[model samples]
Target: MRAFACPHCSSLVHFENSVCLNCGSEISYSRPDRAFVLTSTGRQCANLERAGCNWLVTGDGELCDCCALTRTRPADDDADGLAAFALTEAAKRRLLFQIDDLDLPLAGRREDPVGGLAFDLLSSAHEQVVTGHESGIVTLDLAEGDAGHREQMRVQLAEPYRTLLGHLRHETGHWYWEVLVDRAARNEGFRALFGDERASYADAVERHYSSEPPAGWADAYVSAYATMHPWEDWAETFAHYLHVRDTSQTASAFGISVHGPALESEPEESEKDFDALIETWLPLTAALNAVNRSMGLDDLYPFVLAPAVLDKLRFVHDLVVARPAYVPAG
Candidate 1:
């Protein structure tokens, strides 16, 4: 995500900041302008009238430009005051910035008929809220914000990587594929590689849950669950694309030097080539890990860049840049 500053105080700001630490200015992300702006609306979000959140937004809501989605308020008595709500909003805006910056296609939630994307920052597993929901609306357990809770979930899932940002990226990938790729032209190729997506989804899920991920899974998939179904394959690849782009951007922005022949070529900033991207990414990741080691920190990027994974990444890039026809949902 691009760096943001408090419009009023000009101090570096976080997406979730309600009051500016430097100047005490209120911050709001405009859903229209796709920008963070100073808000005079006190400390509450304008949408609080409709939804329970009192966090600030840059201007009048014509629709949150960030996600192009809306929420009806949470309960007023929700503890953590507005801080929790603000944190959720900030994270969402950061994710939306990546979405917009990438020009990723969007599909809205099934329950909320709004044309824009949706979000569900659920209170927790113990809250009155139900445990699960579907469609374009992502239901994140608020406990996910806690480091210990997230790590526990990560371990339980046996995932190599997990983070709030990663979850947002992965879930959004599913939504994008639902609209952008699940159409016409691209069916044949996608089917050939990922298997026929026309199969019964419930059956596929049941089968996958029962069966082990394909042997040498990383040779063909980014994550093991991606092997569960074609839809998952697509989502994992999409999330990885975001992962590659955003991390590289961050590296470049920080003026970190990336050496080696792989880093020699510049990736097309407008429309990226996946091949060139990986070439740069591999070297850059090595550099990043080296730096992390210097600081006695864990590897910043923990996964290996296998050729099979690269192929999947290419499929993702092809879909995004080619705007290939979408296949029907399996």
Candidate 2:
């Protein structure tokens, strides 16, 4: 979520910008370069016609890296569904951008058919769709894109926070569990912090919905939903890490510091340092919540991070940073 500037005019631009307003230069995201570049080659993603994807084609005039990860999308004839799909794709692009920034490995079905990253952006209009991750495929219910429908579900489910971006971040956590955590060496440390994931997932879910979290859940878990299972606790905490990292980066990019100059210092690279992340995150969120209250809006960050939760977040941070950059075998 760092600020992007147009290469041609040096004007501030957005990640989703197609045409630079200042210089009128056409823009496209280059996967290899990981930045918005001037498209002198006139190459656009194959999905531009149907999905409004603005990323540059990587090769052979086909789908871009982000779009290629999508195994299925809503129907073209379904206008509402198509609109929702666009929003979902935008959020997914943001997610992928951060993933790339962290230099995490991304394997598609083509690379590993058995277990690799993929997406299923399904519309729930025709049928009920459960949003979850299985293997490496993440399914999202498109109806969540609609503001009204999203709010309705948020209230019904009694969730303090929910959004398209949050869903992508959360589900991708599950995908990473398979890629990064489901192993003998990693599982030992993971269990010590997040509890043994071997516990029956089905039973956990049943118990969670049938009742409520045990007393003082907030002191132990980030959210009530996190208490459902160890896997869920990991995903929820992982999503919060992304949330904190990205938002803190945005704040740094904009020269935002909460305290006065006497206390103000250079922004820390939150992606690399957990202490710096908490240092910047807590103050920023508090100020942000106050600003939202001034405008009669809810708190931007509704959850609190206890000492125990901070330990879990640190675990996620360490695991992510410790992993070597993903390089495909030749």
Candidate 3:
């Protein structure tokens, strides 16, 4: 994610800001353009029904580009109102930023005849009028919004890092491979690295849960669960790609030296090679970890980058920059 500014007053704005803190301007994100644009009549998102959302839909007036992903909303009786919804919406916006930036195809419910991509942000299952839906749709227990609750869940999951952004990035990674990777052209190289994705997913998960992750797993795997199945391996690697790219770009903008083409002053390494990314990222992560230690926090990046992992990163880089085999919208 790159930095965004308040188009109205040029005040720096975060990916999730509904209103600018500096000039009090309203903000809207254009999905098509993959950017946040300002609106004239800025108002709290809570007033959407009465005052309308400042963010325009992809085209105009029909389905605000941001809300187009929604197939269901929380019940009117649900307490938080639009405040919590806005947070979920904002996370989706950031996810879409990656989608548009990489030209990833959207495979929504409309696209799939049966089990397709869909979303539903609702209250928990404790509600009275229960809907018997659960699978393909991502169920974000709205209660997860509480920082304390999220932190506890993070600890419970034994995850190094967990955040709304991280969840969105990881889940979207799953959706991407399901829709993007072409089976016919799935090179032997891909299978060799990630394993045979065609294997039974349920069996793999059962085995993964039953046994402990092998020792020295970090030597090659991006994450522990990534060793379970090829699909997981792909998703884990994909999420890391977003993590590195966004963090590196942000550092570049902020003039925090890590190691890049200009930073190295080495014409050879700076030639937009994968090594350039690593050169900047390694030093930057080291400095970041040191700062975290100063404040008694865990290392920001806890994983090591082995040669095999670098190969995965190179694959992702090529995938992003490669020309797509265009399939006309039907």
Candidate 4:
């Protein structure tokens, strides 16, 4: 997410900030303006206090656009679940911000019950709650909000990175596949890059857990998990696209135009330049990885985008740019 400044004191604020630290003035995100403003002037979401939501409402609605997408959440009696729900909602808002930036179509369950996006933020305490997307409804296992549990799952799954936002972005990919590719009748183009999605998903998941990914999987797939199925490949690639876009914008917002033998240069709207963004992604991530190494941590971005991966990324980029630019409502 791009950095923000306090509307009251000009102090650097963050996307989730509800109160200005310097001026002590309440602030909230105005979706149409895409900036922080005084809470009194803001179209405050009804969930601002209940869910720790910092976003402003977009229509004449009680809930903000992002919060309205949630169809089900933990009950009030579930204290532990409520805590996790807050963190998950925060991540979901960030995902929606990036989606708007990409100019992708978005609608709440009430807008289109059959295929419009919705979320079920379920707690895994009482029962197993798997994180996946189906029929435009994304289900998240609330345990993912616990740092220790997330770390354990990352290690167990051999994933290089895992975060609440990561889960949100990855699952949103599945939702977009239906909206952007399936509903648009662009499956032929999708198949050329992501393979056929007609394969048995059940069998694919079963086979994936039954053994290791084939050798040389990275040559084509963005991640080892992507080799499991065409659907997974699309999701992983789509999620990676978001990672690159958001991080690239963050770097630009911070004036982070740094690379080996290259630093302190101005970013030229990198997100709009797909080729330039891809070009900068590697070197920028390399510098980030080096910084992490200096701090005795693993690489920030462990995977490499091979030529084939780049091709798939280009396809995603094309699909995103195919949409008209997002213009704030009047």
lDDT of each: 0.64, 0.84, 0.65, 0.85
| Ten-residue region with minimum lDDT total, candidate 3 | 262-271
Candidate 4 lDDT tens digits, 114-133:
77789999998988888999
RMSD of 2: 2.8
Q: Tell me the lDDT of candidate 4.
A: 0.85
Candidate 4, residue 53: CA error in Å? 0.6
- For every candidate structure, what is the RMSD over all alpha carbons to the true structure, in angstroms? 4.8, 2.8, 4.7, 3.4
Candidate 2 residue 211 Cα shift, in angstroms, is 0.6
Q: Write the per-residue lDDT of candidate 2 for residues 1-330, one digit (tens) a residue.
A: 777878788898888888898989988888787777887755888777677787998867388888889999987799998899989998988999889877767888888777778999999898889999998889999999999999998998889998999999999999787666773258988888899999999999999999968899999899989999999999999999999878877777778887622112233343467776787688888999999999999999998999999999998888778765443322
Off by over 4 Å in 2: 260-270, 325-330
* Worst 10-residue lDDT window, candidate 2: 260-269
TM-score of each: 0.77, 0.94, 0.81, 0.93
Q: Let me know the TM-score candidate 3 reaches against the reference structure.
A: 0.81
Q: lDDT-based ranking, best first?
A: 4, 2, 3, 1
Best of the two (2, 3) by lDDT:
2
Q: Candidate 2: lDDT over CA atoms?
A: 0.84
User: Candidate 1: deviation at residue 222, Å?
Assistant: 0.8
Instruction: Write model 1 residue lDDT over 1-330, tens digit each, in one string.
Output: 556678787888765565678988767655455556766633345444433332444335444444235343246676552344455555666677776566655544432364335767666544764322255566666666667877898898778787767777777776776566554456777777778877788888898878777788877887887888788888778888888877776655456546632321133443366666676678888978888999999888877767767876787777667644333243
